[model samples]
Target chain A: MISIKDLSKVYGDNVVYSHFNLDIEEGNVLCILGESGCGKSTLLNILAGLTPCEGDIPKLRTAYVFQEPRLVPNLTVLGNLRLIGADEDAARQMLASVGLDGLASRYPRSLSGGQAQRVALCRAFLFPADLMLLDEPFSSLDLRLKISVMQVFKRLRENKRITALFVTHDVDEALCLADRIVVLGSGGIAGDFSNTPSEKYGGNSPLRERLFALLSGN
Target chain B: MKKYLAENAYNLAASLLAVVAMWLVWIIAYAAVGNDYLVPSFWGTAEEFFSLFAQAFFWQAFAYTLLRTAAAFLISFALGLVAAALGVAFAPFSRFLRPIIAVCRTLPTMAVLLLILVWTSPKTAPIVVTVLVLFPVIYSQLTSSISGVGGELAEMARAYRLTARQKLSKIYLPQIAPVTVAQTGANLSFGIKLTISAEVMAHTYTALGGLMSEAQTYYNLPRLAALTLCAIFAGLIIELIFRLISRYAFAWQRRAEA
Candidate 1:
């Protein structure tokens, strides 16, 4: 389990998080749903060790999928994967898994938005990280592209089952991918619930409604 | 291959046209001046320029000047790269270098040459002056390029736990290569110009600047014009070589553009 206790983060006059505590179970895909500027990204950054906060945060090797693909422009697709220690065959295999086969030699500039995001996903999965921190990885994509990329992400997550903290403002994304849904508001986690088997079936409607209400309340 | 050859041919033609335009301007200027001592005729200067190749003294001076310029450039580049890297790695160091780089950038080259000549020999004065003049330029270029590696990429590297060697080879070097190459070419040419000026002032007898000084004392305008032309051609050749290196070294950039 990954634990964050007594996390206090402040930027000058603004307090992003104060004494915030959360425990993430192993192998659980925790989706953090929040409105804009509700400390969603800050939380993920804290987990990724990119941000300094006053807390007892577990130190774990993390794979990050940022809002942008963040691939090195000069590196080929496979070369980018190889940058983080992915071998040639394994990188090729991972690229194929994300439907980016035959693009091993292609640079990031040649890849379309959706294709680049897929490569980012491939890179994140290829790295042997104990935890994955994804901050709105599909936020920039159009709806059609979003759905396709989300499907690719879902397939990767299912295969690896790495503990992930997926931060997004999209309710549908949370419902589709998250094993545990968290709604962050001004005070803290306004709502938290397990999206169990029953919730995936008929219970989804009420759960979605409740999440929407909680977000609007914020 | 056809397109590449056609492009090269067009560029070569354009460059020739520029040279012709320069000669036309020189011919007009000579006519306006109407004095051989003031503005030697283009043909006379060209004859002198070609005849320079046969003289052992001219060759020796050319070699010495070339050697000094190269020495200054290599030293300045190395110092700049090391300082820029340190500045990038440490925020306080970057802050500390700000004022020093500012002073170096604003220093008067001739005044600094006078001071350096008083302390160092005439042979070494030009090299020192060129280093002092070009160090800030190379440092600023490298610092900007290194800092421009993008915060997103750095964060990504950190998150992925890329080792120091990995970061340097896979991220920093490739990101900085294009800018560094262009800056290196420009600085080298500028270094040669500054070195020549210092050599002229210091009266370095075995350098191109000393030859120009000799021509000036004798009022041999044609030889002086010829030496100046040699400097111009040298600058152009250096720029072209670097442009070719930039093209081939960063071929990935060209492929991306295509």
Candidate 2:
């Protein structure tokens, strides 16, 4: 579990967030949605302790998948995996999980943007962290890759209580991946819409148009 | 294969032409000056080159100079790596050490040579000079490499609970190896030059710098030309070796380049 209370940050004259409070539970995926320059990524950085924050973040280790893959270009696929302290076999397994089994000896520069993102995703998941902070992890991925990686996460969350904070600009992505979609606007946590609507709803509760209408009308 | 050869053939030809043009200029200048004592003709210098290459004394000096350069590089390399590791692992230490590196790197080379000369033997002066000249190069390179190893990747490492040694050997070292190789090329080439320059001043026994200094003192033009050629050849060889190392060490460079 992680908690943020009344977190505030300013740059010169602009306020990023003020009196901001958030709490996350283990095993559930929480998606933070906002446009560019709206401090979504900055919020993630503060949680990861990359930014100096007025509020406290949990002491437990959290894996962050940055907007950029941020992989060392000189390192091979296996080398990148080894960075997270994964064994050689574990590295191979993770790569295979991401459909990168043939590119073990390959470097980041050799990989396409999608493949690089997959490697980054695999790296974060392979690392044993209490929380995984994903900032647009699949933003560069094509349709098929996106769906596949989402399935990978779905499979992962089944047996493991692996908490995640998946950040994205896309409303659909928030719906597809997150268990609880926290609609963040200029009002950050404007609405807490549960995508996992039970029984007859079968998880894909409200349609995109209906959700967009609710967000706009509000 | 054809594309590769076609791309590189132009560079080879251009380099060849440059060498030929330089040789022609040397011939013309030497002949026009008509002063064998001051500047020997092309053929005369070429003969001396062959003669020096065959001499055991020249080889001994060359071996001594190489060993000294290697020692200086190894010393600076180890120190630079340790300093960089410390700087990266601790921000406060990096802040403390950065200014010292900037000052050392920017200090006058000739002044450093003079200071070391006063404190050490003629032979040992070259070693000290080589270290001082090379320290900044390796240190700055290593620091930049380490600093560029971003916090996001480091957090990923932390998430996995990687041991300190694993973090260093697996993550830190590979990230820095390419940059270190690049700096090694630059520093080693400079190291060879610095060692030779120091040798000229100190008149260290069995160094090409010593040979050049002796040539200058006695007005031995052919010997001077031969020794200058020797330095160029040695510097070129060292740079080529580093070039090879960079290619193998950083495959990502090749991948991006292709």
Q: Write the per-residue lDDT of candidate 2 for residues B1-258, one digit (tens) a residue.
A: 687679899898999999999999998888788889766888877899999978998999988988888889999999888888788779898899878888877878767778888888888889888888788778778888988887766865654566788777767787777767766777778888899988998888898888889889998888898888888888887888887797675667676633
Worst 10 residues of 1 chain A by lDDT: A196-205
List model 1 lDDT by residue over A49-85, tens digit each: 8898897888888999999999998898999999889
Off by over 4 Å in 2: A1-19, A23-25, A52-57, A88-91, A142-144, A155-161, A197-207, A214-218, B1-4, B82-115, B150-155, B158-164, B256-258
How far residue B233's Cα lies from its native spot in candidate 2, in Å, is 0.2
Model 2: how far residue B17 lies from native, Å: 0.8
Candidate 1, residues B58-146, lDDT tens digits: the string is 99999999999999999999999999999999989989998998998899989988888889999999999898888998998898899
Write down the worst ten-residue block by lDDT for model 1 chain B.
B249-258
Question: Residue A57: error of model 1 in Å?
Answer: 1.5
Q: State the DockQ, from 0 to 1, for candidate 2.
A: 0.44
